[model samples]
Target: MGKVKKTRKNTYNYNVDRKKLRRRAKKKSAPRIQCDEIRNAWNRSKSLAGNMAEMGLVADPNKSLPIRERTVIGEPSKVRKPYVLEGLKAAASLPSKQTMGISSDMIMYVRHMVENYGEDYKAMARDEQNYYQDTPKQIMRKVNLYKHHHTKEYQTLLASRTKQ
Candidate 1:
């Protein structure tokens, strides 16, 4: 038998770009979360809640985490454990893509879950195209940039797009 050759995919070169993402991140005005922020804040919650079965913390979304009946805080006894902990748990359980927000499949899944599950439990995911797009004017500008670099290759690509 002859050996088969495998076709390789075109891998994007991130190395050809900047050395660090932080440099560009620091220049922004207000502190904004990055587009690629993945939070793992619920790992501890899951572990702790799992361990504390005696506390009788059920997985019901309507109820909150079961703290020991009485625990003492230093001064302010009126305060509660940060509400973000629950949100983190819920977000961790969500089946949405990390990069492009919510996909169509995820939306459909949400729709189904909302119908079958509880409407209060259902949440919408961010829905947008993952990749950047160039407007017609921007496309022309990019063509000009590429034409400036490699005139022959640029012309060939542009010509192919118009030939249909």
Candidate 2:
């Protein structure tokens, strides 16, 4: 072997002296000029006025004029209601009779089927309750309430159907 070239073990900044590297770093990171300092510099410099104009800041001291009068339109005062009161007001405004009618119809339909089917009504009612998304007790209560209110009409209808 003639002459072997020396290779660096740590290639990262190996050629640069540590002191020279630190000095270069200090020069590069000299201290950032703040907004106030930049503004003052821009105000003093005539050449920097164009650059400040692009940024639309208070760049020039002579050109900057304070607003004499400001027009502020007052917003309407809003009345804040409690969540419970708001919910109640919304509920009160809704057409609740329609939903009540639908629930009544479901109960009546189940009751009518129970009356027509007789002893086997429980099994049919179970399936009907599942379709109506109600429990057996709820369905029974509704059916019983319907029967109690329209006892005469219901009895007459049943009697008429049986006779036929």
Candidate 3:
């Protein structure tokens, strides 16, 4: 014969726990205060008088402290670059199929970088795009490769397209 199954029941009662909690809560109604003389010298006493003064109950905000002026020095002020519709227009134009050993995505990515960040190749490498996933050193190598192969042709193509 198979063994009989044992039944389980939840014995958790809220009323019993609630009564216990209320009894404990009543015991903590009054908080004990520490005398300043009994406390460590380094520790500040949190008396009612100190709290009231901290809330500006006895002091004027204006007379409390003088504001110090901040002077910026040794840093060149950032001047906004002139309007550049040409770079955007150039990047937007699709590259020709005749461009050797270069995918359209690579051309577009480089052109986009040039349009937005100019020759700041580190900024270009730090872009969140998959194409710019490589470290700055690797990206610089790729940029040098692009420059060696297609910089002049790309520039001429851009000049012609802009002229049109």
Better candidate by TM-score, 1 or 2: 2
Tell me the TM-score of each prediction against the true structure: 0.18, 0.28, 0.30
List runs of model 3 lying over 4 Å from the truth: 1-100, 130-132, 153-164
Compose the digit string of candidate 2's lDDT tens values, residues 103-145.
5666567556556654244555566445675655666676666
* Residue pairs in clash, model 1: none
Give candidate 2's TM-score: 0.28
**Which candidate wins on TM-score?**
3
How many pairs of residues collide in model 2?
0
lDDT of 3 by residue, 33-131 (tens): 353322222124555434424332322444334366533221123212112223335544858666558667777766665555555668877787735
List residue ranges in candidate 1 displaced over 4 A. Answer: 1-130, 159-164
Give the whole-model CA lDDT for all candidates, comma-separated. 0.40, 0.53, 0.53
